[model samples]
Target: MSQELHPNGALNQANELSSMHGAELTERYNKSLLGVFGTPSRVLVRGAGCHVWDADGNRYLDLLGGIAVNTLGHANPLLTSVITSQLATLGHVSNFFSTPTQIALAEKLLEISAAPAGSKVFFTNSGTEANEAALKLTRRNVGTEQTPRTKVIALEHSFHGRTLGALSLTYKHKYREPFAPLPDNVSWIPAGDIQALREAVDETVAAVFIEPIQGEAGVRELETEYLRAAREITQAAGALLVFDEVQTGMGRTGQFFASAPVLPDVMTLAKGLGGGFPIGAMIVFGEENTSWLTPGDHGTTFGGNPVACAAGLAVIHTIENEKLLEHVRETGDWLRAALAELDGISAVRGRGLLTAFELQTAVAPKFVSAALDAGFIVNATDEHTIRLAPPLIITREQLETFLAAVPQLLTAAV
Candidate 1:
């Protein structure tokens, strides 16, 4: 038997839970939530601009930007207002219905992508879902069940998503081993290896997925020459080229899409698409590819919710209005140059705000812990790599503070 509480009692209970400090909240989280993420470093209460306050009332600069999801930073007034206003007007409707906000967002995505006239967009609740939809769309290019173009190519060290279909395309052994036998016939190629891509992609191949900047793989990048070669190879073989720009898109690389001029047949976007709000998009370029996924082929209940679409619009509008692309380019250059000169730093890689540096010693975990203790937030992608993806709005002065403390942080870690 369960005990029932009065409405006021439930409200009070919520208030009490919200008022709890870091340690208590962490304990509650451990008990209530799944342990897949391990223990969170801090129970953050609130955020503003480029900083967040933990439940214990300590402030820390947010350099990871919610793993490159918070495009406009935390608690942005414009984003907040847009979301609230849309919620008040129309929050959600089934996929059977359409909304102005959703239509406008689709139009905007196609425009920014420089997609051809007949290009189309499919909305989803997350990057994983977007990738899943893309996988299905790619399968459409496969001739038929009896004589199917069964091969799909993806780069080694890539992280697509955790879902089964997207997981099949992801190249990590650890992530795939637990799932056992994902969708078959997917081939893994080395990143930026034009020869491997050319050799792998043939008429029997349906599609090839590439991340312009491989964020989870320590900000590894695919060069333009390689991308162009991929385009040519896939085109010659009549296979689709897909760019998974979940991390590098939406002004993260100081551009709308990281791989420009060298376009793909399909592109998937999320992460920063809604500026912290949950939304993902799969843009299929050209008339032929756009027509592949017809009605009833793929559908999502809350994919194109009005509120989420409104949030995406606000993020894009803010980026344009604030001219953040230029800011990201300039600041990213400065930040990378500074990181390269720091002690114990061996190499810096990345374009715009999506950046990472290798440590001389394999103490990235310790370095990250020290950074958190010093009121700065960063991520260790591996034992030797630290990735930084601060909010686009973060200023030079704020980054300078972190830069100044790097030597001391490295010393502490060592």
Candidate 2:
């Protein structure tokens, strides 16, 4: 059994956590909630900074940051203030009318993608929606080839999103198997295999959607040689190189957009980009890709809500003002080195604050539960791998403490 630290003085209490505040209330959602994610472990009630208190009043340090969504930390004042102020003034107005926040965010995204000055952007409310938009744009660019603009090359173990269109691009067998015949013309090649990419891609391909760093594949990073080869092959095939930065964008990987020397024709962003709000964008560079959809090609309600855009703007500004990129770079190196010393661990990979480590055994699910008992929270991407994508605002000291205790936590795993 674990214990909780008392609020005021010192003593920790046994985590006999009889009943969390919202535990009972959450029980009613079991079947009605759909078994997609299964029953959640705890009924969380409040969150501040990187800590969350469950219904039972147990506080835990959240290292996953809601799967890397809370970039500035939970309930960040800057984001909250901006949302409150914006909601007070203006909320959702249809796309029929243009709002400054929407336009401004679109322009800011273009600037960050480093696309040519006149690059265009389309905003959505989630990473999947952005991928949908990008897919449409790709179809438009290919324009009815002999194979009908057929064939898409995506890396193995890549996770784009859940929507039918996005799922077609996502390579998870389970997600794709059950939902068979997803928007077709998609194929897969090993993530870092240059030869595979070279052979798999050609004029028949429409686009190559890839994550600069594969978050779902346990933070498997694509080597530079691989990225370079992908660029060459995709270009030779006349296929657009699409970088899905849904998990690595907005300073998560120490870059506004995760890429190397070659700029992607299309970049899809979500997750940390909006700081805790839901907002996504599909960036199109060059006139050829920019003009994919002129009008009435695709549309969504609440895609560019002014409130969401405000949150995104504040997030980007905070990242710049606070210089979070440097923090991620330094802290990431420190965490990686420290984890190397932790027992039951094997290898670590990733960049900036996005990192994943493989344990020597396939007990990560047990390990993750034990981590919660130890006052820390993490997500296991695989049966043998744990991923760490803490909020970019986490201090060096916090990570050091977590890393130092990882060995002991691993020992506790059954």
Candidate 3:
């Protein structure tokens, strides 16, 4: 028989954890909830500023940041305050009319993206909806003639979203095959290959969607010149260049927009835009392009809710006021270097806070399991890839502690 010990030196038999908060809750979840996610990793109870506590009262340094959604960390006071205040004033207004906060957030996005005057915005509740809206816009841009130019070009190993239209653009066969007969006229090309992009994008293509930094593909970042090439090719083909910055936007890539150098005709944003709140926006540049979608072309009931917009405003304010961009650049560089020095890590990829490390062996899941036991949170995006998208507000000391324990954790995992 084995035993577990409490921090206060009390011995507990292994079977005694049946009454623990996490165990009990997990059991309840397994019985009641759908098994879409397989099993709950942890029954987290509360969180604060880059850390969370599980139901069992075990604390963990949250390096995953809700899969890069919790931009300012959990329960940020400024973000919470704005959301509460906005909700108190005006919770939501249908697409019939817009609120001040909603309009302001749109203006902020335009400013951040350096979108030209007359650019337009459409909000959604999540990244998938945003991509869905973009997909519709692309289809509509060329009109629905007998042979409409509705073809879309995307990169392989990329993830756009799960919605039928968005999933059609997502390159994973496993995710796509199960839900076959998706919207047709979509093609995949190798990422980071300008020639592939040039060969794929032609007059028949309606749009070319690329992630400034491919987040779900283990933080694979495409080169600036490649993006420039995409822009030129898309423009020549009269096709819209759509940049999916759902994970790379809002200063996660050390810049306001990871594709700022090569501006796209359409940009889809979500994830960190509202810190932790659910909001997504698709900004289309060029007045002619914006004019393609007239009234009734697209709409969302709760896309730009005042409360969500307020949360987004607060997140942007905090980032600018606190100068977190500079911190992300410095800290990300430091963290990359530190992780590279680890014995088991073969390479590090990505920019700013969105990072992924390649392991020496295919033990990423084992490493993630060990990291959980070691009081840290990480994600195994693939068998050999560990993605780390910590809160931009994470302190140097917090990351240093994680760094110090990396070698030991890797050894134990291997």
Candidate 4:
């Protein structure tokens, strides 16, 4: 016996649940919702292409692209079509059964992985799980299921995610400080410091995790030379190099997985992997390392949701069929140029679709809000850094429109 709530009251109920609509609704949300994010921005009602409309129908350019997850933009027809067709065919079947979409996605991921000796993928629902699974597999590689090795070296300002294992690896103190007794033995190394990494990785360390672009710390691209150096260091020491491609993968960094100078032994991917749907994977290289986690070591239920896999398949196919990497390379060069030309923007960082600018002043929040007022969506991470990770499908005209608004918003603050 169950009762259905009408959409009329449902809207109000939703507002009461966690939305910051009006003073009354805001108060209700404050009382119940976790205070982590503090307050909600306007409720986004609909989205299309690179634009999103709030509940009040105010449209915005959506340059952040849902924190880089919406690589194909909001409500992409391809994502919608694949998800619909897959749902109609078969949606969810537990690990007891197999679906074509699930197996196909795994195979496609491996095809893209195409490293020496071939790789295998493990599915998860989010980047955090992908990282957690990767970390667990790393533990196994260190040998001894009993006292398993504990040390992991992560980069400073790197953001893996908020889960216990991933949080342990995240470099930011604020995200990890509150939870003091984390799953231990994690050390923070400077992003591009090869010697420091050399010191950090001894025989005791199980894995070394890094993000090619440290997205949360205002987009720091690890030098390819340093990456190659890390490879030599890790290989010599026998510690695995695990790349957390949660932000820069899936054609975002123009290389189609931040295809670095040195291939990592393990790569974790999410964000744009499913093109908007939630899907994450941990790819282990070759036979020797790919079998790190036997069955019963790690798993997820809704990770390979048929619809998500189909959406991922569509996303990968679209990236290849539509030839988006070329667009990203050319458009990214132009966007970086246009952004760097803006007065008072001190420096531009990142490559491909993932790019950012450092402000000469300390009013980045104001700049972000001003951009919103100008009908553009951009974010300022610290007092001096503005991040821009837009859709891979954004056109030259669309990028020009965004570029046209930068100088005004940036210089307007002062």
- Alpha carbon lDDT of each predicted model: 0.93, 0.85, 0.89, 0.84
Can you tell me which runs of candidate 3 are displaced by over 4 Å? Answer: 1-20, 143-147
Of candidate 1, the 10-residue stretch with the lowest lDDT total is 1-10
Score every model by TM-score. Answer: 0.96, 0.93, 0.94, 0.92
Between candidates 1 and 2, the lDDT winner: 1
lDDT by residue (tens digit), candidate 1, 248-312: 99999999889997889999999999999999999999998888888789999989999999999
Q: Which ten residues in a row have the lowest lDDT in candidate 2?
A: 8-17
In model 1, what lDDT does residue 311 have?
94
Ranking under lDDT, best-scoring first? 1, 3, 2, 4
lDDT by residue for model 3 (129-202), tens: 99999999888767346646868899998899999999999999999999999999899999999988988877
Consecutive 10-residue window with the lowest summed lDDT within model 3:
1-10
C-alpha root-mean-square deviation, candidate 3: 6.8
> Per-candidate RMSD vs. true structure?
2.8, 6.5, 6.8, 3.2
Best by lDDT: 1
Report the C-alpha lDDT of model 2 over 1-414, residue by residue, as the tens digit: 222344422322223233435556467558458878888877776799988888778888889998989999998998999999999999999888778999999888777667786588888999999999998888875635355557888989999999999999999899998988789989988888888888888777889999989998899888777777787888887888998989989898877766856688888889997888999988888876776788898998888899999999999999889998888888888888888877788898888888899999898998899998787889999899999999998988888778877888888885
